[model samples]
Target chain A: MKTFLILGGGTGGTMVANKMSHHLDPAEWKIIVVDENENHYYQPGFLFIPFGIYSPADVVKPKRDFYPQNVEFVLSKIEMIEPDQNRVKLEKGKRTITYDTLVIATGSRIAPGETPGLLDNGWHKNVFDFYTIEGATALSRFLKFWKGGRLVLNVAEMPIKCPVAPLEFLFLADWFFHERGIRDDVEIIFATPLPGAFTKPRASSILGDMLEGKNIKIEADFNIMEVDHTQKAIRSYDEREIPFDLLVSIPTNMGSEVIERSGMGDELSFVPTDKHTLRSKKWENVWVIGDAGNTPTSKAGSVAHFMLDVIVENILRQMEGLEPLAKFDGHANCFIESGFDKGILIDFNYDVEPLPGKYPLPGFGPFSLLKESAANHWGKMTFRWVYWNMLLKGEEMPFESQMSMAGKWK
Target chain B: MTNPILENVEFDDDGFMIDPNAWTAEIGEAIAAREELPLTDRHWVVINFARQEFDANDEAPTLRRITKTTDVDTKELYKLFPGGPAKKAAMVAGLGKPTGCI
Candidate 1:
């Protein structure tokens, strides 16, 4: 019998397990998913957490609640991936499980200590990160009753989970401060290593304009060397220091520790993966998805959602002794919350930069692309419902696996 | 734009070789040649601007904005470029060669 082992029952693993469990015959193939934690977080919701838009309760649930009924669910930590041996070691039981196919969906974690003094005395006190539930909950209480002060939003490094989240936090903070009647007193600054507000040209112009208009200060291409928590300041590699009262940091993100133990990952622990096929570069039967894959795309939930079909299709093809289809186009779409009851959506694939377009349908989208509208805001809110229901279950979304460029214009 | 050592030349729509263009022609060409260029030039403005749009707005800016903001018009911008500013800049940036946004 063919045995399939999926590591990390997060977004990628759960969806793929569900899709495979339904398609593969039970008599021939067995599916099992392993994860260290029981909680499944709606990571995108983390952006709203600091703003009190989503409490910890709203973003997390038991991982088992979303697993397919027939699949075996193992709640344990991964000790190592012995790819040559085709086995995975469990940390708790110290047992080894062999598999015909293995999928690594073990996502990333925040590494605040990577920066000097970040995890020191001010670790969760004066400086905070909302990437985790505990951090978000703590920050919410901290932000509450916190009178106006210099609030610096810092990105420790690139390749962090949910790249736009920091920007979203700034936008929401703008709204949050205004709502609190402390907009003027609270100084908001964005310090990033990127030359501009973003990686792409068009959106940067628009969003940069928006940032300037909103009075949020931007420091570009400023590589942070250390956070001097002792002095309440961030010192860039060039010795430029930005003093702050409250530091909302998006710490550096790295993949699972098990990948490092097995010598299968880069310095950041991200698995090197085929951009289209989702297969590990080290092994034939090994696959990886989500934030675990070192693919050059925003580490957002939508990218994982877009990768589901391609990964499942390739996995099935391997079983059939057929060439795996190299079809995933790094498809990523996201909703950008631009304070004041408006948001924007942009959809594109590997080769295509986002264009001004309508989504899901041509010229009739309920959401606007590249242009902020209230409908897009509504769409962003409604996605929480969709994620809990359709996405985790491996149900086919209305959109196609490959990004459609139909509604977009030059 | 032409690179002396890389044997690389800028191209137009028809794949015809072309001359250097843009506010930071020397730097853009240097990037294409795998050489480091100063990041502070206004030449970065277009690529940076385009990347910003691609990230937040997720679309390449129209030729109009790319020209207006970067101080390089469309004819010059599209010459060394292929289709979009992001693709061109990403290739020149050479940071793990973009997987074509797929």
Candidate 2:
């Protein structure tokens, strides 16, 4: 049987395994998933952990629970990928495995050390990152007793995963502090590298207005240079400074180090992937998924979900000696949680920005697009269940692989 | 309008060129001049790389990507284009403005 090896076993890898398992003949092909950690995290739920909306236990499940019975799950560290010989070497005790085709889903991680003075004694004490479970939990603990000062959420660079997350954090912070009855005491600040509230113009303007409404200040065009521990400030390359009492930093995000060790990645350790094909640019037999690929689209789980069908189709075509289709159009769907039981939905692709409209059904959407509604909030909350149950199983979702402009207006 | 690169050149409100195809290396030099930065061989390396990336991807690249692919580091990017290396690099490279998503 030919082996279909998948790396990381995260959202992208697990989804690929599920979809490929159902598509490929089980008698002729054996699928294997490799990961270092046994627990699969509901990463989107991590955003709620800092606000006490989600506990640590709420977001985690054993990696074994999700994969199909036919697929093999290996728990071990990847020493290096010998892509030249079509084999991967696991850590010392685990045996090396050879594969017919490979999938790289080893996603990005926040590298706090990449920034100067960001990882000092004040790392998690005064400064925290909500991307990880530990950081979120720690911040939750610190925020409980704290009489707040300038609570700053800074995006160190762009193309970070869940780009709307920082804004959502600020929105929730506004709600969280208000709930605690310390709204008057806490001052929230949003410091981003971009010139506006978001990447695109329309979304940026709307989100900017939202920030203004929340009384959370926007420190735009703040290309962070260093964290001044002594001064308790983040200094920009342009010599601008923003002081913060509690610094929630989204540091420089990079891809898996194993890709770096194997010399298969770009400068940020991400596999250089074809934007349309989702295939590795350097290696023909290798495919890249999720945040591991250098696709210009948002590094989001929704993008990975949107990419699932395209990769599965391409893989099966290749198995039959057919040319892979240039099918993917950078479709990304995200629900931005804007606290106080309201949220916003955005549906977009490579050619389109988040336009104003109703989603999925277009005009009849329960979820409003680019505009806040209570239904969007519940949709985001309901997604946690969908993620574990249907999404991982590669069950057909209501959304299509390609974006539709049906309900959207220009 | 502060330091016009050429006559009859229409620019966007943000001061980037209206038409990317209308840009020449001479225009790039003048844009760099507008930022008070003279083109060096190193500067040409970045300009050339950013343009090549735009040709391949349609949109311009982020500062991180350019620094990663080229030998240019983050510190050097700041030294070359003092205020904002990304916007300045895209301006000098004659590519459309750099954009990214979450």
Report the Cα interface RMSD of each model, rounded to 1 decimal: 13.5, 2.2
Candidate 1 error regions (>4 Å): B1-102
- Model 2, A78-175: lDDT tens digits are 99899889999999486899999999999999988888999987988999999999999999888888887889999998778888999999999999
Query: How accurate locally is residue A311 in candidate 1, as Cα lDDT from 0 to 100?
Result: 90
lDDT of 2 by residue, B31-84 (tens): 888768888998888889888887886767777778768899877888888778
Q: Give the winner by TM-score.
A: 2
What TM-score did chain B of candidate 2 earn?
0.86
Clash pairs (backbone) in predicted model 2: A163-B102, A362-A407
Worst 10 residues of 2 chain A by lDDT: A265-274
Cα RMSD over interface residues, candidate 1: 13.5
- The alpha-carbon lDDT assigned to residue A52 of candidate 2 equals 90
Evaluated at residue A19, the lDDT of candidate 1 is: 88
lDDT tens string, model 1, A214-289?
A: 8999988566778886789998755579999999998878888888888998657789898889999779999988
Show model 2 residue runs off by greater than 4 Å: A92-94, B1-23, B34-42, B48-61, B65-73
Docking class of 2: medium
